[model samples]
Target: MNERATLITNEIVEAIRGVLRKNNVTFGEYRAGFMHLVKTQQAGEIPLLTDVFFNSTIVDIENESRKGTRADLQGPYFVPDAPVITDGQIAVEDEHKDKPVMVLRGKVTDLEGNPVAGAEIDIWHSTPDGRYSGIEKHGNMDKKFYRGRVMTSEDGSYEARSITPVPYQIPNKGPTGHLLENIMGGHSWRPAHVHYWVKAPGLRDVINQAYFEGDEWIGNDSCNGGLDEMVIPEVIENGERIMEVDFKLEPAVAKSLQAAE
Candidate 1:
């Protein structure tokens, strides 16, 4: 019987036990906590463990040189092939009229600082009220709202008009919420930010999130894992918040064609 699997399982269990022992937790206490977690799951409550596991799966692309722009979490709400538009306006609904308007202009360039024309940038973000479109709360099934795609011009310049993003809490109503508020004593809020998925030929793809500068949760982003480089400068012009940022992409590595000798 799969002795290797059994050995690994035992090792993992022992590791957990080691941490529990270090924390002065007894088996009874652990068992009681597990039972509470089970009850919470049975009641359709999302546990903090789920979010921990989910966030762990999100990979952060680090910029070792700290040049250009670094990548951030792509998040779980991205929809491929969103409607392409030239205006780059995503927040156009009447309900969003009262929200602060934002103008985002940027240039896509290679490492050498040359503009990369025709690059596609897919952008999406949470609404001003902190609800993302296509989610259960928003109930957007067929149409895509607050999400769109824009292409770079002949000079690799692009602009988008969207509402200013607002800081919002993660799903904090279930076991996850309880753990953040009680057991861990941490908050489950993310800083105001907008997501971007940029793609260009012969260059590596970039998925990033640009954060607002003065967000209250900037120092306490729960999901971004404390990447300060994601924050961008903000300015006000003509009663609109304007953010100007540039992107630099690295050359893509070609697939190896040699056969194993």
Candidate 2:
């Protein structure tokens, strides 16, 4: 028997039933809701809807016993195989010369505080104008900008330069976007953040987004996935916006040991 599936499915069914009952939802309303879900699925927006509404809870539950950095959803904008950055610059193209520059420096370490050299950190984020490069839907340009991979040096330190992120609205041109904006009575703005994905051999890879401190949408993320530990301040000293944040990875051996236990 598929015990876990059965248990989860039953629980979900019960939860939906409770909502229906509590709201005294009529058959017409229920049918309309069902059709909306169908439209969302047909429009390939189920993932967006799920991420906007529920992925944060899943991340939180899975991270309850984790000892390293917290994990987060990769979102829908991730593009793999970004070019490696050697000049410490994340923004390419000449147009970004006028954009505000942001410097991100960090160290990747193990749970025991030992530095993990040569860890590959992949990063991508939306532009200050609320567009992500290489995403056609974000901007007409499909060139890679503000996206690259950097490796932690011998001391596990890494740095990259890019433009600061600004709050971006979820693309509301599709069915899912319409549902979130029109029917959900919710805003589609996400706080400014930088997306990070780090990996090292024999260590579990972690993907997380770091939000800027004092963003008005911090507590009201459209996805509800923001964490206090994942927030960083806008460090402006000498007229430069440089910030520092570190990540730690627990050894894979530890996860295996825990499973055995």
Candidate 3:
């Protein structure tokens, strides 16, 4: 193996050994656990270990705040070019309006507090039932529901109407569920949140999620994507849930082109 691979393998082996020692696991116990994992895989009831490990790594990187809005994982459900929306448009369909209605409004600004007018903010989120739009589970193939793109106006402000997202468990029938629930002894739920992909000229493109405050999973996100800085408090305005959040973008670093001699 190459140097990096060898180092990583050794590190993982050491970590496993440490856990085994700490847990007082004997050879027989270790063998039994290993066999159980193998059997689970053979039965096709679990996801690949690589995917679980990758997701765990993502969880380990949460709450890293540098400047501006701290970034979070994009999860795995972003679709590009959702129908463009004007200010104050509703993104959710009437059929899915069982949950409390919410209005999300925000301003896109630069680090220096200057408005980034005309910035594109692509937003999407899970249904109140925790299923995403345009996915097979939702039976939405052609039309995009609960997802759209809106541009900031001249003052860098935008708004949209939708249902408030709620916490829901991740897919629990697979190996990832097994790892989180059985082995890790942790809940497999993600906190209520909305995803945003913001882009503007001369600014760094940001793909992040805004979480809801007071969510049960906010302190225990399955994917480790929750951070206090990303949390938005909810208010009741005219019988609708209202969340106002502002985004600050950092100027994009210019890349130099190769000069022709």
By TM-score, the best candidate is: 2
TM-score for all predictions?
0.82, 0.92, 0.80
Q: Is candidate 1 or candidate 2 better by lDDT?
A: 2
| Regions of candidate 3 where Cα sits further than 4 Å from its true position | 1-9, 21-28, 31-65, 137-143, 253-261
Query: How would you encode candidate 3's per-residue C-alpha lDDT over 1-261 as one tens digit per residue?
Result: 578789989999999899998999988999988887886678664543444346545544532433566567776677777888765564666777677888888999999898889999898888777878777645664446778898998999989988887787766766657777987797778888988888899886777888777888887777666667778876789998877878998876455521210
- Candidate 1, residue 91: the lDDT equals 48
Q: Clashing residue pairs in candidate 2, if any?
A: none
Error of 2 at 185 (Å): 2.2
Where in model 1 is the C-alpha error above 4 Å? 1-15, 36-68, 141-143, 253-261
Question: Where is model 2 poorest over a 10-residue stretch in terms of lDDT?
Answer: 252-261
Candidate closest to the true structure, highest lDDT = 2
For every candidate structure, what is the RMSD over all alpha carbons to the true structure, in angstroms?
4.3, 2.4, 4.5
Q: How does residue 142 of candidate 2 score in lDDT?
A: 58
